[model samples]
Target: MDHIKRPSLSGLTGKRHSSRDRSKDDAAKGKQKRADSPLIHGQQANGAPSPASRPAKAASTMSIVIESPPNIFFGTPTQSTGALFSGQLRIAVVEPEVTLQTFTMQLLATITARKPVAKDCPECAKKTTELFKWTFITDPKTLRAGDHSFPFSYLLPGHLPASTQGMLGNLEYHLDARATTRPTPSKGAEEITFRHPLPLSRALMPAPEKNSLRVFPPTNLTAHVTMSPTIYPIGESTVLMKLAGVTEKHEDHQQRWRLRKMSWRLEETEKMVSPACPRHAGKVGGEGRGIAHEDVRPLGQMELKEGWKSDFDDGNIEMEFRIRPSGHVRPLCDVDSPTGLSVTHSLVIELVVAEEWAWTKRPGVATPSGAARVLRAQFQVVVTERAGLGISWDEEQPPMYEDVPASPPLYPQSTAPERSTSTSHPHTAGSATPAVARAAAAMNGSGDMTPVVSAMGATQRPPMERRGVTTEYDGPPLYSPSVVPQAVPALNMGGLNDALPRDEDLEDIDLGESMRRPGPPSHRNSAS
Candidate 1:
C-alpha cells in the first residue's frame, strides 16, 4: 500500500507544471478585472453626464483691430446741425497661409431699441429702427496672410440728428470688419468678425426764439423756466424759473398758497420714428414699435422758496435744482443723434392749492376735478462730464449758445491794436467797442442782473465775447460746447478751436522776449 502511494517521477513532474500554469492564469485574470472597473473613466458611481458629452466651440483663425483718431467722432464744426465722422481700421491675418474666401472692412451706424428681460423672447427682441446707415464700404477681396488697414471718413448731413442714447433705444455708431474662409481640411466655412462703438455728440438747437407753451385746463397756470446756461454743470444747477398765474387773487386778504409739490425729472424717451422694416413701421411713423419713456425719479427735491409761493404773476423763482448724473450712461446734452434716439430733459412743476381753499364755500363754483396744475419747461440740457472730470475750465472756455458769431469771418484781418500794458487789446477784432465794454453793455441791457443763459467762458472773460433736428424735431435739441464750451455751447457744439493759446502750451514758449520786443510804431500813426 505504501509503495502504491509513492507516485512515479513523471506523475510528480506533471503535477508541478499544472500548479505553475494555474498561478499565471490567476495573475492575468486579476489584471483584466482592474482595467474594467468604472474608476478608470470619469463616469460617476451615480448616473450623470460625462465630460466627453459636452458641446464644442467653433474654431477661428483671424483677428482685427481698430484705430480711431485722437478723438474719434463725426460732429458739427462750421454749422451746428451737420455732423462729421472719421476713424481708421487695422486688420491682421493671425493664422499662417490662410486663404480667405472674402474679407471686408466696414463702418456703420445703427439705432436699436432693445430691453434685456428676465428670459429672452426672440419676438420681443426684434423691435428696431435704422435712423441712417452711413456705410464706409471696402471692396471684397482675397487677403494674403499679413497685416492690412482701411481708412474711413464721413461728413454727415447737417440735418442729421446728433448721437443720442436712451432707455427706449440707442443711436449707436460702430466699426465692423469680417473675414470668411473655408477651413483647409474641414468641410464647412468659418468666419471671423469684429465690431466696436464710435463716439459722437450732437449739438441741441434751441427754439428759433424765446419759445413758451402753456397747458390749459390743468389749474390755469403759466410757466416758463430758464436755465442760465441751458448747459449746467453735472450736479447742482441754478434755475431761473418764471411761474405766472399759479394762484387766483381773493379780495379782503392776500391768500397764500403752498406748492403741493415742485419737482423736475429727466425723462428719457426713445421713439422708433423709423422702423427697421419699412412695412413693419406701419402708419404714423412706426406708431408704437419701440417707444420708451423712462421717468427718472428726482434724485433730490424742494418746495418753492417762500417769496415766489404767493400768486405768481411772472414771479421769478430762482432756485437751485440738483440732478444726479447717470451712472450707466453718459448724461448726454440734448442731441437728436442720427439714430432714432432723442435724449431730452423736462423740468416739471406741479402746483396745487389746498383742497379747502380751492373749493371755497361760494356755491355753484365748479372746482376742477384735477385741481393740481402740471407745467413742463422743456429745454435741452448739456449734461456733460467735463465739469466732473476736472477739464480745463480756466484756460479753455466752453461754448456759449446765447448768440451766434458771424461764420467764416476773416481772422486777424481786423485792424491791429496799440500795444498796452493790460494785454486787453480787445479780444475780438474789427469792432470799435472793446470786448469787455460790449460784454458789460450786453449784460446790463438784459434788464435784471441775473444771467438769462450762463456763459461757457472764464469768469473773467472780456464780456463782449459773450457769447435741429428731426428728420425735423418738435422740441429744443441738446449740444456740447468745448471752447473747449468752444463754439459747441453754440452749433450743436462743433468743438471750436482754441482761439487764444493755453498756459500749459505757453510754458514751452518764452514769451518774455516777444512781449518786450521793440515793437513797431502804432498803426494809427503809420497810417496818418
Candidate 2:
C-alpha cells in the first residue's frame, strides 16, 4: 500500500472546491473595496452622485408678494401719471437666529439684443439699467427663525419703455433682491437671492381716425389713406385707400393707369444700442457708448390681384381691406426707450399700375401701352394694446367721503303748458263742456285722439252720474234745440267713420267751419 500514494477523489474534489471558493471570495472582497472607496469628483463610475453626497442647506429663503395692482400706464408718456409698484420681500430664516449683513432690492430694466456687436461678450448682448433701489438693511440686523417681510414701493415713470419681447431684441423688467448673512461661529456667510420678472404695458386712449395723403411727382397720381389712430395686435384693422388722378385725357387719346397688382406688408423695425461692459468698453468706442443696430422684418403681408373698384373715366381707384398682425409672430407693441431701444411699425403698400390708351369717345375700350410703373407708399401706424375697460388707477378709485357731494344733483323742472280756462262762445246757445272742448282741440292737434271719444261720450251724461263722481256743470247740453242742427252726413262705418277723419286728413278739413255748425248726437253717442 505504501508503494503508490494517490490522492483520494473526495479530497481532490474538496480541495478544488475550496480553491474556487477562495477565488470567488477574493473577487467579492475587491468589489466591496471599490464600492467603499471615495468617489472621484464627487461622482461614482456611473456619473451619479454618491449616497454620502448631499446638497448644501440654505440659511434663508426669499419670496415676493405683490401688493399693488397691475403695472399699466393709462395714457401717453407725457400725460400719464405713471404706475405704482408695491410689494413685500419675505425672507424665511432656517437657523435659530441669523444676522443679516446686507439686504437690498433693485428694479432693473434689461435690454437684450439678438444680434450683438460682440457675439461672445455678455455685456454687449444685454444691458441692465437700475430704475429704483431699496436698501432694507444697511447695518447688521438679527432676525429670528421665522418669516420676515420688508415692504417696498416705487413709482415707475410713464416715459419708461414697457416690457416687450421682440423678434430682434427684448426689453424686460425685473425685481432683484439679495440678502447676505453675517459670518457665524459655525457657518460661513451665505447669500440668498430672489428674482421676479415684472411685465409692464401702456394703454393709449382711442383717438379719431387719421387721414393721410401722398402725391407722386410728375405723374398726377395721388393716394389718400384713412386708418384708425391706433392699431391692435389681435383685432382686424381697416385700411381705406383711394387713388385719384389715374386718367389723363389728351384731346382724342386718353392715358389711364390700370390697377394690376397690389401688395401690403406690415413691417416691424427694431432699433437698439448694444452697450459694452467695462471689460469691452473699448470695443464700442468707449464706456456708455454702444453699437447701433436696426432690424426690419415683416409681421404680416398680403397680395391681391383684384379686389378694388377702378373707374378710368372717373379717374379714381378705391380699395378697402383689413389687416391684422400675425399671431404666430407675436408682434411687439410700439415702444420708445431712452436707452436707445425702439420698436415701430409701418404699413407699406406697393401697387403695380400699367398704362393703357383709350379714345375719349370710347372709354370702355382700351389697349395696354406696355408702360408700367410701381407706386410705393408708406404710412406710420401706432400699434398698442387694447385699453379695454381698465381705466387709470386714479380714475378707477371711488370718490372719497370728503370729495363726494353733499346731496344728489337737482334736475330742471319740466315746462309744461298750463291748462286753459273754458270761455263761453257768443254764437252757440248750448256749448260743450270744458272736457269736450279740450278733447276737440286735442283732436285738431297732433296729440293722440283715442281719449277724445271717451271724453266726449262722458259729456253726454251729467257729471254726477258719470264714473260715480260729482261735479258742477252749469253749461247746457252739447247739442240743444237752441243750436241749429246741420244735416247728418252718411256714416261709412266699414273700418272708420268719415266724419272722424285720421290725423293726416284732419289737416285738409276746416276745423273752424265744423265747430261753427253743430251736428246732432248720433244714437251710438247717446247710448254711450
Candidate 3:
C-alpha cells in the first residue's frame, strides 16, 4: 500500500542494512546444521552402527560342589545290599540366574599328584592325564520334572589298585563346562567352555554309611538277639530265633525296633549211622533208630525270660520249625516187611526280622532307675495237629544198660575210637573233637577232663561208647509200629533230595544229660 522511504545517513544506513541481511542468513545456516546432527534422527536412520552390533561382556563365574553322607554303615563282606557304599560323594550344579538356555554342562575327571608325593614334581613323571567318561546315563536333554531321573555314578579308576596296601592316598578330579547359542542357521554357533578342578582324598577310615539304604544320616541304634528254644534236637525239629534291634530317634516317640530275617539248618555229625539199617538191626531201618533212638517230639511252647522288654523297640519276630519224616528213612525198616513203610515227617517254621518296630520303654527313655536289659523273650505259635500223634500211645520202654533218666543230648556225642598213645601226635586229627569237651569244661569250671565230673569223689567217668549196646528183654516187646508221616516237597532244603548224601562239616560233641554248657556261636546272628 503506502511506500515510505526510510532516512539513512551515509555510514549508519549502510551498516544497519548489512547487519539485517547477515542475521537472516545466520539463522538459516543454524537450521541446516541441526538437520545433519544424529540427535535429531532415530538409531536406524543414523549412519553409525547400533549398540547391539557389539559383542557382550562375559558374566561372572559360578561354582559347583559335591557332598556325601555318612562314611560307613553296616555291611557284610561278601554280599551286595543293592545300596551305594559308604563314603561315596554326590555332585550337583548351580547357576546364579543367568542365561541358562545358552549354557551347556560337561564333566571331567583327573588324578593329580598329592601334596606329600607331588612335592617332588612326580605329576609329569607319572604320565597322568585328564580322563573323560560317561556313566549312569548322562545328558538329561530336557530340564523339567519327570523328564528323567538323576543319572549319577562313581568312576573307578582303571589304574588305581584295590584298598589293601600300596595305594594312592586320595583322588583328584576336574569338571568343565561351556556356553552356546544359535546365532545363524547356516553358520551354526560357537562354544565358550569353562574349566574347573576339584580334588578328593582317599578314605583312611571305614565308611560310616556303607550298605545302608538311607541317603541321610540315621539315629544311633542298639541291638538285642533272642533265640527260641536256645536248644535244638538232632533231627525233625526246627529252631526259631529272632534278632531284633532298636533305634533312638526323636524324643516324642518310643525307640523303634525291627527284625531282619531268620535262617537255620541242621548240620550232620562227622560220624554217620549205617545207611543200610537206620533204626533196628533189621535189613533196613529208619535213620537214628538203628544204633540210637530218634524221636521228633512236637514243638513245645516258647517262653521269654524276664527283662525281655529291652530286646525290641518296635519289633517282634515269630518263628516255627517242623520236622518231616523222610521216605528213605522208612525204607530202612521195611526192606522185607509186608507193607511199605512210611517215615516221612516235616518241620515247618517261620522266621521274621524287622527294619522297624515298637519300642520297649526303658528307664533311660524318661528316667534311669526303670532301665532294664532283656535277658530273654519268647514268640510262640500254637500249632494244631493234622493226623494226630504219630508216635506210639503207650509209654516208651527204657533201654537196657541205659544211664539214669535225664535230658538227652541236643547234639550227637563223639564216637571216634580212642587211639593208643604210642602214635606220633596225640593232638593231631583229634583237635577238633575236643569242642564238646571244652564246652563241658567251661560249664564245669574245670581244666581237666570234663565229659563226666563227679563232685562227690572228684572223679571223672569215661565217655560212653556206642560200639556195643545190649538190652535184656523180659518178654516179647510190643511190635506195634507207629504211623509214619509224609514229608512235603517244600520241606526239602534248596531242592536237595533226602536220598542224596550231603557233605556235612560236623564237630564232635559229648553233650549228655544234666550237662549244661553254652552252645556253638550261630551264624544266624550275622547281618547280611
For model 3, how does the per-residue alpha-carbon lDDT over 1-528 read when each residue is reduced to its tens digit?
A: 358867658658667778779999998897677667655333344345467555654333334434432112112222212112112222222322222235434444432222222234343113234344333223322222211222334433323211111122222345565555333453445444556554322212122221111111142332232222212222233333333334555555454433333333221211112122222224334332322112332332322222123343344333434433332322111011111111112222223323332324442443222332322222321111221222211122355456557777687675644322221112212332344335435654764432332232232333444669554443222231111112211122333333333233233343554684544557434621
lDDT, candidate 2, 1-528, per-residue tens: 799988669767767678789999999998788787765777777558876686877888999999998898988888888888888899999989899999999899898888777788887788788988999987999999999999988888878788988766789999889988888777688889999999999989898889999998779999999999788888889999999999998998899999999999999999887777788888777888878888898989999998899987789999999888887877788999887789999999999999999988898889999999999999999889898888777676799899987897787795643322222222211433334345445654743443543455346645545688778665545543222223322222343333454455556876675465555678537844
Q: Which predicted model would earn the best TM-score?
A: 2
Stretches of candidate 2 off by over 4 Å are 1-30, 35-53, 138-141, 250-253, 278-287, 398-528
CA lDDT for candidate 1 = 0.45
Reference-based lDDT, each prediction: 0.45, 0.81, 0.32
lDDT of 1 by residue, 438-514 (tens): 55446557323233223322233331221122243222213212112122222221223234444456668766755
List TM-score per model, in order: 0.42, 0.66, 0.19
Off by over 4 Å in 1: 1-67, 70-88, 94-96, 109-111, 115-124, 127-146, 156-166, 181-190, 203-224, 228-233, 242-266, 270-300, 304-343, 351-528
- Candidate rank order under TM-score: 2, 1, 3
Candidate ranking under lDDT, highest first, comes to 2, 1, 3
> Can you give the lDDT of residue 346 in candidate 1?
52
Clashing pairs in 2: none
RMSD of 2: 14.2
